[model samples]
Target: MTTTRRPGAYHCGIDAAMDVIGGKWKVLILWALDERARRFGELRRLLPGITEKVLASHLRELETAKIVRREEFEEVPPRVEYSLTPRGVALNEALAPLGAWGREHVIGGTAVTPGG
Candidate 1:
């Protein structure tokens, strides 16, 4: 599908959406944080193959997009947690069926259900 660019449109929804949450890692990050907020270390562990730097970058992008919110607690050792914003939660809801379909048909080697 080709999308037309409008003049002076710095924030087209489609383009902005793709920019915010594009790439494999970002969706996985969103998925991991869907149910509950997690610390940086927790996210790293949940997504085993991702490097710390890459995860940090993705998190920053998501936070900037307003999809993810980061909360920091000051103490002797600072604590940080990441959670989905309302927008992120809505996107997650939209993607849920796609994820389920991928798991069932694409990964499990079964035929995709109609309309999925």
Candidate 2:
């Protein structure tokens, strides 16, 4: 999976970072993989709203960015797992503050009420 670089694009560090992790699903996928390696099905189960195709696409993009590593095992049924690479770990750490903000602010407003 090779991406063609656009001429004169991504002039800043934020540009480069967003190029890798931009989108609703990519960051969520990275968060899911932060704790431990997970198989394809496990990831799908973890992220309830994601469709199979979308999850597959995001995983491919993360793998291409070298943020996530895909490991295949030789077995009777063939097994594969996805885990965060060192780069991904660093990225996740960098996102901690943002995550905290979302949890403290965003989730509070969006959570459902008992009768509403």
Candidate 3:
């Protein structure tokens, strides 16, 4: 899917940042790929609730954004792996505070329910 930028859509840095990592699954996908490279199946396993279609779509978007690097190897059986680029690593770092806030306020509070 292609997104057309509206006039004056992103007026600030936060708006631009949110545009890249706006969806529910993108940040989780980035978190999963933070430590090391993973195959498609591996990502599916790591992110239990995510459907295969959503995973693939998020990965393609991340690759397009230059946040994830997809490497394809030539072998008898084709191999592909996804890893975080420098920008992605920086994004992970940037999100750390938000994660901590969620854990401290949201998770610790009784208002939000925890899930598998």
Best by TM-score: 3
Model 3 segments more than 4 A misplaced: 1-8, 109-111, 114-116
lDDT of 3 by residue, 1-116 (tens): 44343447788988888888888889999999988999999999998999998898889888888899999999879999999999999999999999999889877764475662
State the lDDT at 67 in candidate 3.
91
What are the Cα lDDT values of the candidates?
A: 0.85, 0.88, 0.87
TM-score of 2: 0.84
Q: Enumerate residue pairs that collide in model 2.
A: none
* 59-85: candidate 2 lDDT, tens digit per residue: 988898899999999997999999999
Determine which window of 10 residues in candidate 2 has minimal summed lDDT.
1-10
> TM-score for all predictions?
0.78, 0.84, 0.87
By descending lDDT, how would the candidates be arranged? 2, 3, 1
Stretches > 4 Å off in candidate 2: 1-8, 109-116
Greater-TM-score candidate between 1 and 2? 2
Positional deviation of residue 41's Cα in model 1 after best superposition, in angstroms: 0.4
